[model samples]
Target: MNRSNASRGGVAVLVLAGGEGRRLGGGKPLRRVGKRTLLDHAIERGQQWSDTVAVAAKSADQVGNCDLPVLIDQPGIGGPLAGLASARLLDCPLVLTIPCDMPFLPDDLMARLTAVLGNEGASLASSGGRIHPVCGLWRRESLMQLPAYFATGRRSIMGFAEVIGYATVGWDDHWFVNVNTPIDLAQAERRID
Candidate 1:
Protein backbone atom coordinates (compact mmCIF):
# COMPACT_ATOMS: atom_id res chain seq x y z
CA MET A 1 0.00 0.00 0.00
CA ASN A 2 1.22 3.47 -0.90
CA ARG A 3 0.70 5.42 2.29
CA SER A 4 2.15 8.54 0.72
CA ASN A 5 -1.00 8.90 -1.33
CA ALA A 6 -3.22 8.80 1.74
CA SER A 7 -5.63 11.73 2.18
CA ARG A 8 -3.53 13.25 4.92
CA GLY A 9 -0.16 13.10 3.18
CA GLY A 10 1.55 10.03 4.69
CA VAL A 11 0.35 7.76 7.46
CA ALA A 12 2.35 6.78 10.52
CA VAL A 13 1.34 3.81 12.66
CA LEU A 14 1.40 4.27 16.43
CA VAL A 15 1.19 1.17 18.60
CA LEU A 16 -0.06 2.07 22.09
CA ALA A 17 1.81 0.01 24.74
CA GLY A 18 1.71 2.35 27.72
CA GLY A 19 -0.97 0.54 29.68
CA GLU A 20 -0.13 -0.63 33.25
CA GLY A 21 -1.89 -3.96 32.58
CA ARG A 22 -2.90 -4.49 36.22
CA ARG A 23 -5.61 -6.92 35.19
CA LEU A 24 -3.20 -9.03 33.16
CA GLY A 25 -0.67 -9.00 36.04
CA GLY A 26 1.50 -6.25 34.43
CA GLY A 27 3.73 -5.95 31.37
CA LYS A 28 0.96 -7.04 29.04
CA PRO A 29 2.89 -6.05 25.95
CA LEU A 30 5.65 -8.47 26.84
CA ARG A 31 3.32 -11.44 27.23
CA ARG A 32 4.03 -14.20 24.72
CA VAL A 33 1.65 -14.99 21.88
CA GLY A 34 2.89 -18.26 20.45
CA LYS A 35 6.64 -17.39 20.13
CA ARG A 36 6.46 -13.60 19.76
CA THR A 37 5.37 -11.00 22.29
CA LEU A 38 2.15 -9.05 21.90
CA LEU A 39 4.16 -5.89 21.34
CA ASP A 40 6.04 -7.64 18.57
CA HIS A 41 2.78 -8.69 16.92
CA ALA A 42 1.41 -5.14 17.14
CA ILE A 43 4.63 -3.74 15.72
CA GLU A 44 4.53 -6.22 12.88
CA ARG A 45 1.00 -5.16 12.06
CA GLY A 46 2.01 -1.50 12.20
CA GLN A 47 4.93 -2.08 9.86
CA GLN A 48 2.68 -3.87 7.40
CA TRP A 49 0.40 -0.83 7.26
CA SER A 50 2.92 2.00 7.12
CA ASP A 51 6.58 2.66 6.46
CA THR A 52 6.96 4.70 9.64
CA VAL A 53 5.95 2.87 12.82
CA ALA A 54 6.36 4.06 16.39
CA VAL A 55 5.53 2.62 19.77
CA ALA A 56 3.95 4.85 22.43
CA ALA A 57 5.16 3.55 25.77
CA LYS A 58 5.36 4.87 29.29
CA SER A 59 9.10 4.30 29.44
CA ALA A 60 11.99 2.51 27.82
CA ASP A 61 11.86 -0.01 30.66
CA GLN A 62 8.31 -0.91 29.69
CA VAL A 63 9.09 -1.30 25.99
CA GLY A 64 12.13 -3.62 26.35
CA ASN A 65 14.25 -3.80 23.16
CA CYS A 66 11.89 -2.63 20.44
CA ASP A 67 13.79 -1.41 17.37
CA LEU A 68 11.19 1.16 16.27
CA PRO A 69 11.21 4.68 17.64
CA VAL A 70 9.43 5.03 20.98
CA LEU A 71 7.36 7.95 22.22
CA ILE A 72 6.86 8.46 25.93
CA ASP A 73 3.49 9.71 27.08
CA GLN A 74 3.34 13.08 28.79
CA PRO A 75 3.71 12.61 32.54
CA GLY A 76 0.64 12.31 34.83
CA ILE A 77 -1.84 11.56 32.03
CA GLY A 78 -2.87 8.02 31.15
CA GLY A 79 -4.85 6.21 28.45
CA PRO A 80 -4.52 6.00 24.67
CA LEU A 81 -4.91 9.76 24.31
CA ALA A 82 -1.50 10.23 25.88
CA GLY A 83 -0.07 7.84 23.30
CA LEU A 84 -1.77 9.82 20.56
CA ALA A 85 -0.32 13.02 22.01
CA SER A 86 3.16 11.53 21.95
CA ALA A 87 2.68 10.32 18.37
CA ARG A 88 1.59 13.79 17.25
CA LEU A 89 5.23 14.79 17.42
CA LEU A 90 5.94 12.59 14.44
CA ASP A 91 6.28 14.25 11.00
CA CYS A 92 3.52 12.29 9.29
CA PRO A 93 0.27 14.07 8.46
CA LEU A 94 -1.85 11.17 9.76
CA VAL A 95 -1.51 8.47 12.39
CA LEU A 96 -3.15 5.09 12.85
CA THR A 97 -3.25 4.01 16.49
CA ILE A 98 -3.68 0.43 17.73
CA PRO A 99 -3.43 -1.07 21.19
CA CYS A 100 -0.56 -3.46 21.84
CA ASP A 101 -2.86 -6.13 23.31
CA MET A 102 -4.82 -6.75 20.11
CA PRO A 103 -2.97 -9.57 18.37
CA PHE A 104 -5.42 -10.42 15.59
CA LEU A 105 -5.82 -6.83 14.35
CA PRO A 106 -7.12 -6.82 10.80
CA ASP A 107 -4.63 -6.69 7.93
CA ASP A 108 -6.82 -4.15 6.14
CA LEU A 109 -7.17 -1.92 9.17
CA MET A 110 -5.71 1.18 7.56
CA ALA A 111 -7.60 0.65 4.34
CA ARG A 112 -10.93 0.32 6.13
CA LEU A 113 -10.32 3.29 8.40
CA THR A 114 -9.20 5.46 5.53
CA ALA A 115 -12.22 4.55 3.49
CA VAL A 116 -14.64 5.96 6.07
CA LEU A 117 -12.45 8.75 7.40
CA GLY A 118 -13.15 10.81 4.25
CA ASN A 119 -13.47 14.53 5.08
CA GLU A 120 -14.04 14.03 8.81
CA GLY A 121 -10.23 13.65 9.11
CA ALA A 122 -10.63 10.98 11.82
CA SER A 123 -12.17 7.52 11.95
CA LEU A 124 -12.23 4.71 14.50
CA ALA A 125 -12.99 1.01 14.27
CA SER A 126 -16.33 -0.36 15.44
CA SER A 127 -17.23 -4.02 15.91
CA GLY A 128 -20.22 -5.87 17.33
CA GLY A 129 -21.96 -2.52 17.81
CA ARG A 130 -19.13 -1.27 20.02
CA ILE A 131 -16.53 1.31 19.17
CA HIS A 132 -12.80 0.62 19.46
CA PRO A 133 -11.51 4.18 19.76
CA VAL A 134 -7.86 3.30 20.01
CA CYS A 135 -7.95 1.59 16.65
CA GLY A 136 -8.24 4.81 14.66
CA LEU A 137 -6.86 6.95 11.87
CA TRP A 138 -6.45 10.60 12.74
CA ARG A 139 -5.08 13.75 11.21
CA ARG A 140 -1.98 14.84 13.07
CA GLU A 141 -3.30 18.40 13.12
CA SER A 142 -6.34 17.26 15.07
CA LEU A 143 -4.07 16.41 17.98
CA MET A 144 -3.93 20.07 18.90
CA GLN A 145 -7.35 19.60 20.47
CA LEU A 146 -5.91 17.05 22.94
CA PRO A 147 -4.16 19.25 25.50
CA ALA A 148 -7.32 21.26 26.08
CA TYR A 149 -9.35 18.07 26.28
CA PHE A 150 -6.88 16.66 28.79
CA ALA A 151 -6.94 19.90 30.75
CA THR A 152 -10.68 19.53 31.13
CA GLY A 153 -9.98 16.19 32.92
CA ARG A 154 -11.20 14.06 30.04
CA ARG A 155 -9.08 11.16 28.78
CA SER A 156 -11.48 8.88 27.02
CA ILE A 157 -10.43 8.27 23.41
CA MET A 158 -14.05 7.92 22.31
CA GLY A 159 -14.95 11.18 24.01
CA PHE A 160 -12.15 12.96 22.22
CA ALA A 161 -13.22 11.43 18.92
CA GLU A 162 -16.78 12.48 19.45
CA VAL A 163 -15.78 16.04 20.33
CA ILE A 164 -13.69 16.24 17.18
CA GLY A 165 -16.37 14.66 14.95
CA TYR A 166 -15.16 11.29 13.66
CA ALA A 167 -16.48 8.50 11.50
CA THR A 168 -16.66 4.86 12.60
CA VAL A 169 -15.89 1.92 10.36
CA GLY A 170 -17.50 -1.37 11.34
CA TRP A 171 -15.75 -4.73 11.19
CA ASP A 172 -16.35 -8.28 12.40
CA ASP A 173 -16.16 -8.50 16.18
CA HIS A 174 -13.91 -11.59 16.12
CA TRP A 175 -11.13 -9.56 14.49
CA PHE A 176 -10.90 -7.13 17.45
CA VAL A 177 -10.07 -9.53 20.31
CA ASN A 178 -7.92 -7.89 22.98
CA VAL A 179 -5.87 -9.66 25.68
CA ASN A 180 -6.83 -7.88 28.87
CA THR A 181 -6.73 -10.84 31.26
CA PRO A 182 -5.24 -14.31 31.61
CA ILE A 183 -8.41 -15.92 30.27
CA ASP A 184 -8.35 -13.64 27.25
CA LEU A 185 -4.77 -14.62 26.61
CA ALA A 186 -5.64 -18.30 26.80
CA GLN A 187 -8.51 -17.78 24.35
CA ALA A 188 -6.18 -15.90 22.00
CA GLU A 189 -3.67 -18.71 22.23
CA ARG A 190 -6.30 -21.22 21.25
CA ARG A 191 -7.39 -19.03 18.37
CA ILE A 192 -3.80 -18.72 17.22
CA ASP A 193 -3.24 -22.44 17.31
Candidate 2:
Protein backbone atom coordinates (compact mmCIF):
# COMPACT_ATOMS: atom_id res chain seq x y z
CA MET A 1 0.00 0.00 0.00
CA ASN A 2 1.08 3.55 -0.60
CA ARG A 3 2.38 5.29 2.49
CA SER A 4 -0.57 7.70 2.32
CA ASN A 5 -3.05 4.86 2.40
CA ALA A 6 -1.34 3.23 5.37
CA SER A 7 -2.43 6.08 7.59
CA ARG A 8 -5.60 7.12 5.78
CA GLY A 9 -7.40 6.03 8.90
CA GLY A 10 -6.44 9.45 10.31
CA VAL A 11 -2.99 9.14 11.81
CA ALA A 12 -0.04 11.49 11.29
CA VAL A 13 3.52 11.56 12.55
CA LEU A 14 4.97 14.64 14.19
CA VAL A 15 8.73 14.62 14.51
CA LEU A 16 9.62 16.67 17.58
CA ALA A 17 12.84 18.53 16.80
CA GLY A 18 12.47 21.67 18.84
CA GLY A 19 15.07 21.13 21.53
CA GLU A 20 18.06 23.51 21.68
CA GLY A 21 20.50 20.56 21.96
CA ARG A 22 22.91 22.70 23.98
CA ARG A 23 24.56 19.53 25.18
CA LEU A 24 25.48 18.27 21.72
CA GLY A 25 26.21 21.56 20.05
CA GLY A 26 23.35 23.22 18.15
CA GLY A 27 21.23 21.82 15.34
CA LYS A 28 20.40 18.46 16.85
CA PRO A 29 18.24 17.50 13.94
CA LEU A 30 21.04 18.21 11.52
CA ARG A 31 23.40 16.02 13.51
CA ARG A 32 24.63 13.19 11.36
CA VAL A 33 24.05 9.53 12.28
CA GLY A 34 25.38 7.07 9.80
CA LYS A 35 24.65 8.38 6.30
CA ARG A 36 21.66 10.48 7.37
CA THR A 37 20.86 13.42 9.58
CA LEU A 38 18.86 12.72 12.72
CA LEU A 39 15.91 14.59 11.17
CA ASP A 40 16.08 12.47 8.02
CA HIS A 41 16.13 9.26 10.00
CA ALA A 42 13.22 10.42 12.12
CA ILE A 43 11.29 11.38 8.98
CA GLU A 44 11.97 8.02 7.43
CA ARG A 45 10.70 6.31 10.56
CA GLY A 46 7.56 8.42 10.35
CA GLN A 47 7.10 7.50 6.70
CA GLN A 48 7.17 3.86 7.69
CA TRP A 49 3.73 4.32 9.26
CA SER A 50 2.25 7.45 7.65
CA ASP A 51 2.59 9.61 4.60
CA THR A 52 1.46 12.70 6.49
CA VAL A 53 4.51 13.76 8.47
CA ALA A 54 5.59 17.07 9.94
CA VAL A 55 8.35 18.59 11.98
CA ALA A 56 7.55 20.50 15.16
CA ALA A 57 10.34 23.01 15.52
CA LYS A 58 11.15 26.01 17.66
CA SER A 59 11.65 28.01 14.44
CA ALA A 60 11.85 27.50 10.72
CA ASP A 61 15.63 27.73 10.81
CA GLN A 62 15.64 25.01 13.42
CA VAL A 63 14.69 22.47 10.82
CA GLY A 64 16.27 24.19 7.83
CA ASN A 65 14.70 23.15 4.49
CA CYS A 66 12.31 20.24 4.39
CA ASP A 67 9.36 19.33 2.16
CA LEU A 68 7.11 18.56 5.10
CA PRO A 69 5.25 21.29 6.90
CA VAL A 70 7.00 22.71 9.97
CA LEU A 71 4.84 23.53 12.96
CA ILE A 72 6.59 26.11 15.05
CA ASP A 73 6.28 25.90 18.83
CA GLN A 74 3.24 27.62 20.29
CA PRO A 75 3.69 31.35 20.96
CA GLY A 76 4.47 31.32 24.70
CA ILE A 77 5.34 27.69 25.32
CA GLY A 78 8.44 25.71 24.52
CA GLY A 79 9.78 22.15 24.63
CA PRO A 80 7.89 18.98 23.71
CA LEU A 81 4.73 20.34 25.25
CA ALA A 82 4.76 23.14 22.71
CA GLY A 83 5.28 20.65 19.94
CA LEU A 84 2.25 18.63 21.06
CA ALA A 85 0.14 21.76 21.29
CA SER A 86 1.09 22.84 17.77
CA ALA A 87 0.16 19.41 16.49
CA ARG A 88 -3.11 19.38 18.40
CA LEU A 89 -4.59 21.51 15.65
CA LEU A 90 -3.81 18.97 12.98
CA ASP A 91 -6.67 17.61 10.88
CA CYS A 92 -5.84 14.05 11.78
CA PRO A 93 -7.47 12.14 14.60
CA LEU A 94 -4.15 10.88 15.97
CA VAL A 95 -0.59 12.09 16.11
CA LEU A 96 2.49 10.14 17.07
CA THR A 97 5.31 12.19 18.58
CA ILE A 98 8.86 10.94 18.18
CA PRO A 99 12.07 12.60 19.19
CA CYS A 100 14.49 13.29 16.33
CA ASP A 101 17.34 11.51 18.09
CA MET A 102 15.88 8.09 19.04
CA PRO A 103 17.07 6.24 15.98
CA PHE A 104 16.46 2.78 17.41
CA LEU A 105 12.79 2.99 18.34
CA PRO A 106 11.01 -0.23 17.54
CA ASP A 107 9.34 -0.54 14.15
CA ASP A 108 6.13 -1.60 15.88
CA LEU A 109 6.12 1.29 18.32
CA MET A 110 3.03 3.09 17.04
CA ALA A 111 1.19 -0.15 16.68
CA ARG A 112 2.03 -1.10 20.24
CA LEU A 113 0.85 2.22 21.59
CA THR A 114 -2.30 2.26 19.51
CA ALA A 115 -3.26 -1.17 20.66
CA VAL A 116 -3.39 0.04 24.26
CA LEU A 117 -4.47 3.62 23.64
CA GLY A 118 -8.19 2.86 24.22
CA ASN A 119 -9.92 5.97 25.66
CA GLU A 120 -7.01 7.26 27.67
CA GLY A 121 -5.45 10.69 27.26
CA ALA A 122 -2.38 9.32 25.57
CA SER A 123 -0.22 6.22 25.25
CA LEU A 124 3.52 6.60 25.78
CA ALA A 125 6.60 4.46 25.54
CA SER A 126 8.46 3.63 28.71
CA SER A 127 11.84 2.15 29.40
CA GLY A 128 14.26 1.85 32.27
CA GLY A 129 11.51 2.72 34.77
CA ARG A 130 10.66 6.02 33.14
CA ILE A 131 8.14 7.09 30.57
CA HIS A 132 9.32 8.80 27.41
CA PRO A 133 6.36 11.06 26.75
CA VAL A 134 7.97 12.45 23.61
CA CYS A 135 7.55 9.02 22.09
CA GLY A 136 3.81 8.86 22.41
CA LEU A 137 0.70 8.42 20.34
CA TRP A 138 -1.82 11.01 21.35
CA ARG A 139 -5.43 11.52 20.52
CA ARG A 140 -5.30 14.88 18.79
CA GLU A 141 -8.23 16.28 20.71
CA SER A 142 -6.71 15.34 24.06
CA LEU A 143 -4.01 17.92 23.47
CA MET A 144 -6.59 20.73 23.60
CA GLN A 145 -5.88 20.72 27.33
CA LEU A 146 -2.54 22.41 26.63
CA PRO A 147 -3.65 25.89 27.63
CA ALA A 148 -5.10 24.56 30.86
CA TYR A 149 -2.00 22.48 31.42
CA PHE A 150 0.27 25.46 30.89
CA ALA A 151 -1.67 27.66 33.30
CA THR A 152 -0.24 25.76 36.28
CA GLY A 153 3.31 26.91 35.54
CA ARG A 154 4.25 23.50 34.24
CA ARG A 155 6.00 22.80 30.90
CA SER A 156 7.12 19.21 31.01
CA ILE A 157 5.99 16.48 28.65
CA MET A 158 5.55 13.99 31.48
CA GLY A 159 3.66 16.45 33.67
CA PHE A 160 1.12 17.28 30.98
CA ALA A 161 0.82 13.69 29.92
CA GLU A 162 -0.16 12.71 33.44
CA VAL A 163 -2.58 15.61 33.81
CA ILE A 164 -4.39 14.35 30.74
CA GLY A 165 -4.12 10.67 31.80
CA TYR A 166 -1.78 8.31 30.02
CA ALA A 167 -0.85 4.65 29.67
CA THR A 168 2.58 3.26 28.82
CA VAL A 169 4.05 0.26 27.06
CA GLY A 170 7.56 -0.63 28.13
CA TRP A 171 10.36 -1.46 25.79
CA ASP A 172 14.01 -2.39 26.12
CA ASP A 173 15.95 0.58 27.37
CA HIS A 174 18.63 0.05 24.78
CA TRP A 175 16.30 1.22 22.03
CA PHE A 176 15.83 4.57 23.76
CA VAL A 177 19.30 5.69 24.83
CA ASN A 178 18.98 8.96 22.95
CA VAL A 179 21.97 10.95 21.75
CA ASN A 180 22.62 13.99 23.91
CA THR A 181 26.36 14.62 23.80
CA PRO A 182 29.45 14.20 21.62
CA ILE A 183 30.22 10.96 23.41
CA ASP A 184 26.68 9.67 23.02
CA LEU A 185 26.73 10.56 19.33
CA ALA A 186 29.92 8.61 18.92
CA GLN A 187 28.29 5.61 20.58
CA ALA A 188 25.23 5.98 18.33
CA GLU A 189 27.51 5.95 15.31
CA ARG A 190 28.94 2.63 16.39
CA ARG A 191 25.47 1.20 16.96
CA ILE A 192 24.16 2.45 13.63
CA ASP A 193 26.75 0.44 11.77
Give each model's whole-structure lDDT: 0.89, 0.90
Best by lDDT: 2
Question: Model 1: per-residue lDDT, tens digit, 1-193?
Answer: 4545454348899999999999999999899988889999999998888788999999988989989899998997888888988977888988999999999988888998988887775899989999998999998888888888888988888888888889998999999999999999999888888
Error of 2 at 71 (Å): 0.5
* Candidate 2 global CA lDDT score: 0.90
**Model 2 lDDT, residue 193, Cα:** 95
Clashing residue pairs in candidate 1 are none
Model 2: residue 91 alpha-carbon error in angstroms: 0.8
lDDT of 2 by residue, 8-109 (tens): 458889999999999999889999999998999999999888878999999999888888999998888877888899887678889999999898889989
Candidate 1: lDDT over CA atoms? 0.89
Candidate 2: count the clashes: 0
